[model samples]
Target: MSSTRVSGVVVTPVAFADPPLLNVVGVHQPYALRAIVQVQTDSGSVGLGETYADDAHLARLAAVADVLPGLDVYDLNGLRQRVSDVLRLDGSAQVGGMLAIQNPADVVLSPFEVALLDIQGRELGRPVADLLGGAVRTEVPFSAYLFYKWAAHPDREPDAWGAALDPDAIVTQARRMVEEYGFTAIKLKGGVFAPDEEIEAVKALAAAFPGHKLRIDPNGAWTPATSVRVAKELAGVIEYLEDPTPGIEGMAQVAGETDIPLATNMCVIAFDHLKPAVLADAVQVVLSDHHYWGGLQRSRLLAGICETFGLGLSMHSNSHLGISLAAMTHLAAATPNLTYACDTHYPWKTEDLIKPGALDFFDGSIRLPTNPGLGVELDEDALGRLHEQYLACGIRSRDDTSYMQTVQPDFTRNTSRW
Candidate 1:
């Protein structure tokens, strides 16, 4: 192992423009928050990480950064303990709604873990995937993430994506995404409209792209009965039904009744969540997110557990830029059991902090970077500009339900609304 010590860590909170994509929670705000982490090593290498930049998360990250200097890059467990000891819970712990599986400490530790791994890779002169037991596959596949959206926010002008509220509009949107990015699979974000309307949209997607894999995630907006009904209706067409209902119990109920395999990034979110979910046979597939699962190494562990449990494995995504994408690509390339194409929100965002030619996709797959570390450099100017935007933009937290209130005055969050 290379004995590289971290010299310093810089945490920059940034905000970037986001499209008005609608989901079960609410519309995507004009600006989304993220923290860019840079870990400088004694060996003269800098490793990078990116994650949520909400006020609460940023506070934990800041605390961790304060103590990161002189820490060994290879001592991940020590890093975790250091972060756990430093973290003090505040209201920021409740960002993505109150899921029982959510852990604030994990949120703070994940990005730093990634940053350290990046440094380790650079010090050893190998790719991150090589450190994770080498690449099982050179190309990582990603699905086109489709959302039901308005032309724009209530008062703002429509962005280039336009409105995709109806079946025809959604079909058009998918066509554009596949044509531009060469995505072979599609995942539609549901739970915004009634189940029947969303079902029709999935049917339209199936008809438009015959033989292509398709999925619908409602973020658990339906009851078990409603979830089962939708699953049966689109039984043969969809590859898997994702988060049709909420929680392990609800998912298990729906799974018991439907042949369409159930998948989730919601119910089985953490490592401890695995046993109960597996025992109940609640989820047939687990959508792994490195940000929430701790980091790429932990994600590999999650994949191994899924394989041992006879469950399908795929990656999850939130709104993010190229750094996270590069980390995801390296992790996916190294994971042998990741059978399905991963989900990504990269196509939706118009702006990014990485250099212009950093990442690309062809035929739905990202060719793994051969260079040392993550193989993507941060664009200092873009980073500075986005940081300025974060300073000016006043979105301190992401409350999708509250944001939706502006568009639909009577909007209330009900998981079983349908």
Candidate 2:
């Protein structure tokens, strides 16, 4: 039924400007890395994909690309097999941070899978959402993903988002983001301060925007006791508590004590983790990241599993640019069970690799990109600039703790330190 074949593939690693967004691991690096994937087909159509650009992951992508040239775009099964065969138990390290799984095959397969889907959509003259079943909603809403931060990275000029190290400053940051993006929901990246202090910040956000839905993720910094204490303290103030502590047993312990539903991109990261998590009643909500879940189709499968298990579904994000945003928008638009506003770091970045006007936020939602394929194009000049930024930035991979130590000499990365 199909004639076009993959003619070639290009994986370009790029780094974009980032601010001092603090979290559980430490503060973000000055530059965030991503690999832009372009899958060119024999019929003269090109498809785009984006993913994490760690050195090991880049090597995996390059290995897959070697075998991709002659494969059929429709044969995503074949593509996945090639990735698995190449990466067979070699590099299954956790990517980016604590919430990730040790599945290099899926992490490696993600971008290439997205690119192939883009090619399929382009060949069929349909948006990627249609390939994923079809859009259940015309517009996809995203929450204001707020972070506790310094006004600037060390030794750099202050960025537009000023320091948000306390309750008042956090409230100020939330207000500015909501005002600019029209986001009706907000999530604070916590674990940077003491438990009560962070609780105070949540109360401040609640007071500032009484109409908005609120949530916080400490990235598993607290013990079960502290998690329950915060849950009871903010019982009606917040919608859900996310990753307050690590692992299923601890999460189940906290869930047992609180009525506020527990959510995570941590414990339930992989398919095998699902059964144990369900058995322990660890997580109520699972934040799906296609980048680590083996891309869109498998993400839909993940949604189905969550629905069947009576678990809520939402999307997770990383510090990324327009291409990742476009892919996320299409996937969210098509998934019926993804009811909550997805999380995004789109507002935090000062730069992007794709040309503008294809995606924009209105009332905190991006309307479905109806053009063929991913509905976004690479700005050649911008791509080159970001690639150069990648080269000269002198950072090979993301090491938030190491970067943070350059400023905070005694910085410790213990997850349950509190």
Cα lDDT, all candidates: 0.89, 0.90
lDDT of 1 by residue, 205-268 (tens): 9999998899999999999999999998998999999999989999999999999989999889
Q: Provide the lDDT at 348 for model 1.
A: 84
lDDT of 2 by residue, 1-418 (tens): 6578899999999999999999988999999999999999989988899998988779888998898888888998998888878877743575875555677788888888888888888778899999999999989999999889999988889998889899998888888988898999999999999889999999989998998999999999999998999999999999889999999999999999998999999888899999999999989999999999999999999999999999999999988899889999999999999998999999998888788888899999999888888998889899999999999999878999888899989998858767
**Candidate with best lDDT:** 2
Alpha-carbon error at 362 in model 2, in Å?
A: 0.3
Candidate 2 has an lDDT of 0.90
Q: What TM-score goes with each of the models?
A: 0.97, 0.98
Question: Given candidate 2, what's the lDDT at residue 365?
Answer: 95
